[model samples]
Every structure is written in structure tokens, then in C-alpha cells.
Target: MHKFGVWAPKAQKMSLCWREQVLAMNGPNHRGWWTLEVQEATCGDRYAFLLDDDSTPYPDPRSLRQPEGVHGLSEIYSHGGFEWHDQLWRGSPKTGAIIYELHIGTFSTEGTFDGAIPHLKYLADLGITHVEVMPVAAWAGKQGWGYDSVSLFATHEHYGGPDGFKRFVDACHATGLSVILDVVYNHFGPVGNYTGKFGPYLNENRKTPWGDAVNLDQEGSDEVRRFFVDNAIMWLKDYHCDGLRFDAVHAFLDLSAVHFMEQLSTEVERLGATVGKEFYLIAESDLNDPRVVRPREANGYGMDAQWSDDFHHALIAVLYSPKEGESGYYSDFGTIADLHKSLKHAYVYDGQYSGHRKRRHGRPTDGLSAHHFIHFDQNHDQVGNRGWGERFEHLVGTDAAKLSIGIVLLAPYTPMLFMGEEWASSTPFLYFADHEDEEMRRLVAEGRKNEFAAFGFGGDVPNPEHEKTFLDSKLKWDEQEEGNHGDFLAWTKALIKLRRSHVCFNDGDTHHLHVFSDERARTLVMEREEARVVVNFGDQPFAFALLEGEQLELASRAEVSVREGYLDVPPMTLAVLLSTSEQFENRQVEARARA
Candidate 1:
């Protein structure tokens, strides 16, 4: 016999339909819970729930596997059936972690969770500690970025379904890597969403770009909050995921005094404590507020980290000029100073900005640690939203590209690499989705074209409706073995190794930045606790007056040299230096004399 339960607080009456039998359930405790037991209800059995007098069967909001897709009936799944081999695996701490963000569909040609297994070793070899997957929840169609998820609980069937994901997670853990899943709780997809048929899962009072906001603070919202919180716990507890990266917390329209984010963070922390494991929550926010990752004890939301869009925007704008004819958001950023500010401090527009939103925006992140921000040169949105979806390789030359990598990896923040970025994969991560609705498909295609016009791209944007767009985004695995691609991969690996070996590199403390020149011979020197990093962004050789006893420990071949009390750094190169042995010995002798 199997006991099934679901949260349906809005339903006056709920009945489980399985194998031609309907089992009635009772719940009025404001929990919106319904439960039923049947002998024939087993794994793989298709089921749905009948709510009130609704004739149509609604898929369970917490469906484990929708093998027939999001629009079809939910299939029962036993979480314990699979043998997990990660019994002794404890996740890596967030400090000094190298995160690689990937979309399973485009990570490999097979476009399945199983297909990505072979590349696990590649990521491991690249020194990635955590694999941050884009949203994998079941969405409307077969192909998408997984952001438009209709079934928050179910894994996408095309990506090898539930079992496939379990295997993937297990494989990752076996290789000493942790998995961080990106989850969306703000809004359902534009298609195949049936949560409303069963209850008030959306708030009409609040609206977002997607639609009505999730009912996190309205009447009957208690259960809704519980539903999402439970889902997050399920991923960590049941699926064995190490962390969750919440998508767009800025879109959460809750007005509750406690706030939905605070509630979720508190619960996740409790669950992590109970399990005796380290579970983290990362948020994707555009607010640029440090409070989101601040500790709850200080009356903050208590998220572990958030995406640093300011860092990316500042880096991209100065490095890659706005496309030929026009400029929109990228126009606001242009100087080496902007890049320097973002690298030293997480935000470029802290309490001062007008050109973008026409209003002063963003709060200062002055006291925050660098680990509170996740920095990336290119992510899914930046690449996909482009007119032709060009990667960094297409936008800049190899030298500039290496400089971008150096800035990101050596910065005092956690760094994330988009899939195929290590080797500078040529394929563009275009905006592609499998929308069965003609109107939605047309709107997406048209919107994409219009959006690129501001950037000055002349041609028509690639149609997201075409399967070829999705196919074109897949990584070319063979590139890893050839040409500049191989060189890039090697350089990235060396950088990661260097970062891991250096204690100062892992320190997220912001260093005081000193910039020598702005235009032709610019040089930035950052002094951390015991070491210093000097970077020359210009082509001509530059000199910096270092501390008397400082010596070069690591320097890029092209742009760095040390002699006497001056360090000569070449154009667009970075160098790491530490105090000389004689200096340390002299300091020790002085301390002994003082004692």
C-alpha cells in the first residue's frame, strides 16, 4: 500500500484519481493538505487530483515525475528505490569554491542528464567545486532555459526525468563535487500551469513581468509559502543537493512583515542544521542591496550569496564596446575605474545612478564579504538576450578574453563560469524555447528582435521557434582538444590551480585599489593582507613602486617583471607578489629583540 499526500488548502474537497479508483481526503487545518492510501498506488502509476466540483483532473503540485510532460498526468515515484552511493559525502564549504553554471540540454549533444555524466570529470579537472545547474524543473515544452517552469516539483522529462537527475547528483558527489540547483518560485510558466485550478496559488493584487505574483503574503498564502519551502527542503533532504540558487528574488512581491525570503531562509537553515550538513541559498537579484545576503540576526534576509550583475556589466561595457550603431544599458559603463570599483567592491552604482533607471538606485555593500557575491563574466541571460547570442570569444580578442578571466578569478568574490566558457566555446547560447502556443512563440521571437535593435544589431534576431537555434547552442566537445580552445582551457585550469594554492586568493576581503593611469598606461595595484596583485590594463609597459622587500611569486608571462623596488607589468596582464624571505626573517628578529 502507498500513502500519498498533497497540499491543497484552497480546495473545499479533494479526491485522488488513480487506477480507476477515487480516494477522498479530508483537510481543514489551513495546511491545505490531503492524503490517501491505496494498495494499487505504486511507482509509475499515473495519478491526478479532483478538486471541488472541477471536472478536469489537476496534476499534483508536488508531482515527482511527469513522464508524459507537464500537461500530462503525474507519475508516482519512490524516492528510495535508487541506490545512492554518497553516504559519506559532505559538501564543500562555500569559501574558495569555483562554481560552473551549466544547462544540461546544451552541455552535451545528447541533451539529457545521463549525457552530462562524461563531462563530470572534465569539470572536476577544471577545479570546479560546485556545479550550479540552471532551472531543471518541468516547463511547458521540450526545450527551454528552464526558467518558465510550470511544474516546480517535477524534473523535466526530456532531461532523462527523475532517475536521471538522481544519477547525475550521485555521480557528482562521488567525484567530490556538490550540486546547486537553480529554482524558480516567483511565477509559473505561460503554458500548462494548472495550480490555480486547485487553489489560490497566485495573487491578483500583485503583478510582475511574468504575470500575477505567487501568493506569498495573501489570504491562504500560509500553505503556499509552506509549499515552496517544502520543495526547497525536498531538494536538499531527498535529492541530496548541496544548495539552491533562487531565481530573481527581486520579483517576489510579498509584503509580509517577515518576508517570504526570510521565512524560506530560516527554514532552510533549520533543515540544514537538522541534517548536520552545510546547505546554502544563493539569490539572483538585481536590487544590488547587500541586506539580502546579510545575517538574519542583524535583521537581514540571510541569503548566502547573490549574482553580481554590476560586476559583469562594468567588465563587459569597458572591455567590449557597445555594438556598432547604438547603446542602451551598456552605455552607462565605459571606464577602467568602473571595472576597478566593481572588482574591489561588489557594486558600481551604490546609492548613485541616474542614466539607467532615471533614479538613484542600489544600497552600499560596504561591510559585506566578497563571498556574499557571485561574479561571472558571462552568464545565460547576457549571452542569450543578445541579437546573435555571441559568446565572449566572438565579442573580444583572445588577450582581452584572458584579462576578463583573470579579473573574475582573482577578484575577492566567488566566480562562476558559464558552460563552454572555459575553452571559449564558439556556439552562441541563443534564446530558444519550445512553446506550443503560436501566439507566445511569435511574441518571444518579435520581442527578441526589438530588444536587439537598441544594441545596434541590424539583422533579424534568430527565431527562438526554430529547433536549429537550440541545436546551435550545444557545446562542441571536440574543441577542447584543438587550437586556441585548448590553450584557453589550459590557461583556465592553471588559474584555478593558482587560486586554490594561494591563501590570499581565497580571501574575499576587499583590498584598497590604486590606479596609476586611466587611458594609455593604466595599472591597478590591490593590497590584501600579506600579498599584492598588480594589473596593467593598457598595452604599454607600466611601473609600480612596490614595498621595498616585496618579490614576485607569480606573474603572467607576457606582462610582468620585478627589479629593485619597481615592478614592470605589461599591457593587460596581472601579477601576484608576496614579501621576500629576508623581509620576514628581519621582522622575526625584530620581534625577538622586542620580547
Candidate 2:
């Protein structure tokens, strides 16, 4: 016998469309749950929910399988079928994790989960402890950015189904790498979205640029809230994912006592404790709200970490050499002081500013750990949102790439790397979508241009539906062995190694972190414990007085030197200063022994 269930509170009558036979589902069950058991219905059967005797069936909101397109029938999938591996995998700790974010579609030549398997060991060996993947939830189209995913419960059919995802996770755990899946719960994609027909899934009152805000706090929201919360848990427990990257928590319009994010975080944490594994939830919130990552005991929405966009903007405002109109947000960050404040505190705009939105933005993150902030130089959104979709390596030279990498990795906050960012791949990660709907595709293409026009971003915005747009974003792995890429790769490796070896660099302590900046000279120094990271952004060489017996641990380039209480820093370089203490020598010996 097969058990089937769905949430359709508004439906007076519901039927299961399975294998040319329709079976009626038992009514609302006092909690809006429709369930029925059938002896004939079995796993692998293509089924959907027929509401109010309508001939058209909508895909289940909690479907695990959508083998046919999102608009087609959902298939009954059986989990726990894949051969087990990584039985010893207990998950790596959250603090001091080096995360690498990559899109499965663009990361490999095959553009599938299995296609990404071979690269896991490469990242593991590269000192990456965590791999945060872009959304793989089932969405309409052969290719997409995955933010527009509608079927939150189902894995993207094009990029390997549930079984393939299992293999990928198993492979990652076996390779000593933890996997974090990025999930979008704020809004569903425009195309093939039929959730509204079944019930109140989209809210008309709450507005966003993407679409209607998910009816998280509206009436009859319990089921909608459960849908998303369950989706996150499913990824962690069912798929063996280590953590979840919540995409845009600020977009979730929830006024409930326990917000959707709060509830989700609580459940995930409970599961982690129950399973005796470390599960984390990182949010991509632009609100700069410290409450997102604050402890729940302090009456805050508990999350493990949040992406520090302020750090990216501060770095890009100066080093992003191709200073075009794409500097819409960078307008708020243009001084050495901004970079210093961003590193010292969590957000640059901590409840200050009026230029961007003509209003004060962001709260101060005073008590959060450095691990609560994830810093990065390049990411999927930052790169792909541009008209040309150029990376930091393309904007600034490779030398600047090394400098930026050092700044991000050495900072007290957790560091994340974008795919191919280590070796400076030549491919551009352009914004691309493959919606078959002509009108929807045209609107997206036109809307993208209009969105950037306000920011003065110029150039021909490529048609998102075009196959070339997606094809062009594919990483050229062969380029790693090429000219400048190889040198940059080695530089990245050395920096990561040093970060792993040094306790001060990798520690999660944020209270002791301090920063000093020279606005005129365009140099910044971040001192943590016994070590300091000094960066030079000036055209002319900049130097600072170092402590006696201070040794150079790492430098982005060879031009940086430490001599006689003077640290000579060259243009566009980074220097890590560490005193040659007995403790330092012992740690270095241990690091070399491990290496």
C-alpha cells in the first residue's frame, strides 16, 4: 500500500492523478492535510493533485519528484534507495570554515550533480572545508540561475534528480567536505508556478521586485510556513546536506510571533542535536540585521551566519578596476575608512546613511562572532548580475585578485570563494534563464535591462533565454593549467595553507579583532591576537613600522618585506605579520608536519 498526502485546505474535493486512475483524497483532516492510502499506487508513479474536480492537475507543493516538467505530473519518489557511504561522516565544525560556492550548472562540463563529483576532492585538497552550492530545486527550463525555482520540495530534474544529488552529497562527505544547499523560500519563479490555484501561496499585499512575497504570515499561512520549513529540513536530513544557505530572508514578510526563519532555524538545530551532527543555516540578508544571526535566547531569529555584502562593496568600490555604472551599491563605499570599519564591525552601514534609499539602513552587529559573517570577493549574484558578467579577476588584474583573496581569507570572518575564482577562469558568469514561455522570457530580458538602467549600467544586456548566454558561463577547467591562472592558483593555495596553520587567522573570536586604517595612504591593518594583516591599496608603495622580531608569514607578492621595525608594502599587495615567538614556531612545525 502507498500513502499519499498534500495540503490543500481551500479544496473541498481533491483527487490523486496517478497512472490513468483518479482517487479521491480524504478531506481537510482538521489541519488542512489531505491523505489517502492506495494498494495500487506505488513509487515511481507519475501523480499530481486534482482540485475541485478540475481536469487540470497541479504538481504537489511538497513533491519529492518532478520527473516530467514542473507543469507536468509529479512522480511518487522513494527516498533511502541509494547505496550508503560516508558512514563515518559527522560533519566539520562551523568556525573557521573555508567555503567555496559554485553553481552545478556552470561548475562542470556536464552540468549535473555527478558531473560535479570529480571536483570535490580538488576543493577538499584546496583547504575548502565547506561547499555551498547554488539552488538545485526543480524549476522550469533546461537552465537557470535557480533563484526562480518554484518546486521547492523537488530537486531540479535537469541537473540530476534526487538519486544523483545523494551521490554528490555522499561523494562530498567521503572527500572530507561538507555540503551546504542554497534555498529560496521568499518567492517562487514566474514560470510554471501553479501554487496559487491550489491555495493562498502568494501574497498580493506584500510586494517585491521578483514576484509576490510568499504568504508566510498571512491567514492560512501555517501550511505555507510548513512547506518551506520542511523543505529545508528535507535537504539536511533526507539529502545528507550539512547546512542550508537561506536566500534573502529579508524578503520573507512574516509578522508571526515565531517567524518562518526562526522556526526553520530552531527545527534544524533540534535535528542537529538529535542526530549528533553540526547543521548550520546561513542567510543572505541585505537588511544588515544582527538579530538574524544572534542567539535565540536573546529573543532573536537564530541563524548560524549571514553574507557580509558590506565587505564586498567596500572592497569593490576601490579595487574593482573596471569602475563602470555597475557601482550602484558601491556608491556608499569608496574610502579606506569604509573597508576598515567593515572589517572591524560587521556592517559598514550600521544604522547610518541616506544616499542609496534615502533612509537609514542596517542595525549594528556588536556581539556576533566573526564566524557569523561570511566574506567573499566574488559570488554568483555579484558576478552574474552585471551586464558583462565579469569576475573580480577580470575587473582587477591577477595581482589584485591575490590581494583581495588574502584580505577575505585572512580576515576574522569566515571566507568563501566562488567557483573558478581561485585560478581566475576566463569564463564570464552571465545572468541566464531558459524559460520556454515566450512572453515570460521577453519580460525577464526587458526587465533586466530596465533594472540596471536606473543604476547607469550600460552595454547590451544579453537575452537571458538565449542558449549562448548559459553556455558562455561554463567554467573552462582546462584554463587552470594556462599562463597566469596557474600562478594565481598556487598563490591561493599558499594563502589557504597559512590561514589553516595560523590560529589567529582562523579563530572565530570577533571581540578581540581590531583594525587601523590610513585614509590618505590607502593602507589598512587588521590585528588579531599576535598576528596582523596589512594591505596596501595605493599607487605608491606604503610602509608601516612593525614590532621587533616580526616575521612575514605570507604576502600576496614578493615586493612586501619586513626589515628593522619597518614593513615595506608595495602597491596592491597584502602582508601578514607574525612575531617569531616560540608558540608561532611550534604551530608552524605542527602545520608542516600535518602538511
Best by the lDDT measure? 2
lDDT of 1 by residue, 348-417 (tens): 8888964877888788887888899999998998888888889887888777787788778877799999
Worst 10 residues of 1 by lDDT: 511-520
Give the least accurate 10-residue stretch of model 2, judged by summed lDDT: 320-329
User: Model 1 misses residue 567 by how many Å?
Assistant: 4.9
Tens-place lDDT per residue, model 2, 1-595, is: 6889987778899998888888888977877788999898778888888899688978988888899878888888877677868778998889879999999999999999999999898999999999999999989998998998988888998989999999999999999999999999989998888888777988989887787999988887988888888888899888999999999889989899887888998999889889889797999999998999987899788999999999999988878643556557777888889888888887999998748768999988877778899999999998888777888888788778889988988898899999999998899999989888789888889988887676667767778889999999999998997899998898899989988888888787877687888888888888776688889998889878886557787788888876667989999999888875675567567769999
Candidate 2: residue 436 lDDT (0-100): 81
Q: Can you give the TM-score per candidate against the true fold?
A: 0.93, 0.96
RMSD of each: 3.0, 4.1
Q: Can you list the residue pairs that collide in candidate 2?
A: none
